[model samples]
Target: MVVHSISRYLLIILSLFLFSLVIIECKSIKFSTSLSPKSLDLKIEKLTHLHFYLQAIIGGDHPSEVKVAGPNTSFIAFGTLEVEDDNLTVSPDVNSMTIGRAQGILASADQNELAYLNVLIFEFTKGVYANSTLSLLGRNQIDVPNREIPIVGGSGVFRLSRGFAITSRIRFIPNSSVVLVFGCYVLHY
Candidate 1:
């Protein structure tokens, strides 16, 4: 009789445990966001990865906010500004940076070229990286007035191999004194 009673108790416990698990699993959820940009006006050929704080002087302010999408993935924006720091040199890790291939350059249906900056993921043991261009891509231009833009959809993943701080800068000289300073950064996985 005692053995039968023990068996009944075990069955009840197992059923209760399974029920609890089902309830928990049903309540759990997951979330995600798309990084594809509708439009990109700049083709940043040379990207110079700088210390988070050092980029401000040269117009490197990024996204206006930071967002958490998951436990391991988060979205944060650095500031945008342009600084002419001759002392600043290309990051040795990625010195020979090419925007067309490096940052994943691609063409849209409109024949508009788009470069994916955020998707450039690289694994680093905490070193610096940098790249530059003779001029920002002819078709793509960065206007300081347009402060915030989406980072997604491109030919390559520039900052995705590993988590690292990235700083992008551009210099443009028109016929006049209107020098446009544009830059931004991302702390991504």
Candidate 2:
């Protein structure tokens, strides 16, 4: 009789446990801004892998704001990035292949070292005002050939983007001016 009673108790416990599990599963927390219990699913997608070159002209007279704070200066630079199959120099004009532009600011301790935030705006027929913005925090040492920086967040077309940008010095003109080429690859949703 004792053994039978114990088996009945065990069965009841098992049934109660299962009931509790169902209740918990039904009450799953929804990740959303709404007060309702409805859940919001996240969307996963890939943006274009924009391969372009920034023919940026640095050190005044261009469309950039540069404030020299002794050896470490701060600046805001803007330039054109032409789209091409390979990393070759191109004309900075409104052409059929003209994809976008590189517009941003940079804080530098030296000529080759900087922290920058750049926005790349695509001027394609379909994309129109689509843009990819990036935050680059790194040291572009004079000896280092290139610096790969992070493309953080963005707006318009490039929403919630995360990726990397590469900057390589193409030319250093007279009077501390420079021409830089920036290549960006990003993923957005």
Candidate 3:
């Protein structure tokens, strides 16, 4: 029994000593004030797979659907938004971003509703880019059905984003200037 007790006591002491060493090493780790609260080591690499495919309907002269506000010359225009994923084809599913709306005070008609200053905040589904409304501006849309627009800025996940949008008119109705199908591809970082 004496030998047993001695061995047990030695084992207990060894464990206690190891525990103390662990505690000491843990306390020795000093947090430096110079270190950023956010991990400075956090690497920011562009997510190449991140892409935006949207179909925008520019509201023309529709009594209820399209309302014209602000100055008579520079009217506020609101339109619908539909966003898709990798499939460039605009076949929207339940998971697809849909029923989105975009509104912006139109610039002078002299600018043909295509002005760098004509900005529209487009809202859509999901949390990623939902916090901040993505902003868009018309770049070039003269006689060409294909127009390149600018993504001036964004909010939420897309905050401070800068990119361009290439839009091709899939359909255009000049009768009431009320309908048009545009294929918009927007890429940003």
Candidate 4:
């Protein structure tokens, strides 16, 4: 009889403990609604245009881009991966006013064509947008005269930025170097 009474008391205590835990968890839980830009006092800013040249020195003693991994293949090295810290300049010349660096990885994804999967970050170091960065993730077809890549996100003055960058190969040398011009149209707030 005493054992049965003790078991009943234990069961009641356990039930009370579990109920208290559930109540505590319910009190801690927070349900929030979605907030709008107006509620946050954020205004949409003006659209901005940025033009620059990306100078990639490929095969010199001080190359800006290098193939980190790839199979021993032909000139069009498919499945190859290259990492670059190319110079973003105002002009096509390597000695032009430096704006930033296109630092990222590019992989030859398409086996049939000259298409590269580019995952790059445009890190600005000069002018009004200094210390800012814009992330770019898209496919770049080298054979195309004008390739458009989407600018995904950004920081600093370019926070919440969305845009597209038109890339055109200005100059290319066989096994030497390549210079590409980028015209970026961005909208941010």
TM-score of each candidate structure, all chains considered together: 0.21, 0.49, 0.46, 0.84
Model 4 reaches what TM-score against the true structure? 0.84
Model 1 accuracy (lDDT, Cα): 0.30
CA shift of 92, model 4, Å: 1.4
Q: What total of clashing residue pairs does each candidate reach?
A: 35, 0, 0, 0
lDDT of 1 at 115: 26
RMSD of 2: 11.3
In terms of lDDT, the poorest run of 10 residues in model 4 is 37-46
Residue-level lDDT tens digits of model 4 in 1-189: 999999999999999999999999999998977988788556977799999999999887999998888887844589899999999999999899999999999999998899999999999999999999999999999899999999999998888888999999999997788999999999988
Error of 3 at 17 (Å): 68
Ranking by TM-score: 4, 2, 3, 1
Residue 69 lDDT, candidate 4, scale 0-100: 88
lDDT (Cα, 0-100) at 104 in candidate 1:
17
Model 2 residue runs over 4 Å out of place are: 1-43, 59-65, 71-99, 110-139
Q: Could you tell me which residue pairs clash in candidate 2? A: none
RMSD of 1: 17.9
Task: Please report, in order, the local distance difference test score of every candidate based on alpha carbons.
Answer: 0.30, 0.49, 0.47, 0.92
lDDT of 1 by residue, 1-189 (tens): 999999999999999999999999877854755554333432433433323211112123441112222223211122221122222222322233312222212111121322222222122222333332112121222222333333332212243221223233433322211222234343222
Candidate 2 residue lDDT tens string, 49-165: 655444444445553334433332213222212221121233422233544544443433343333333333323222443343444444344335687777766666566667777
Highest-TM-score candidate: 4
Model 1 lDDT at residue 31: 70
Order of quality (lDDT): 4, 2, 3, 1
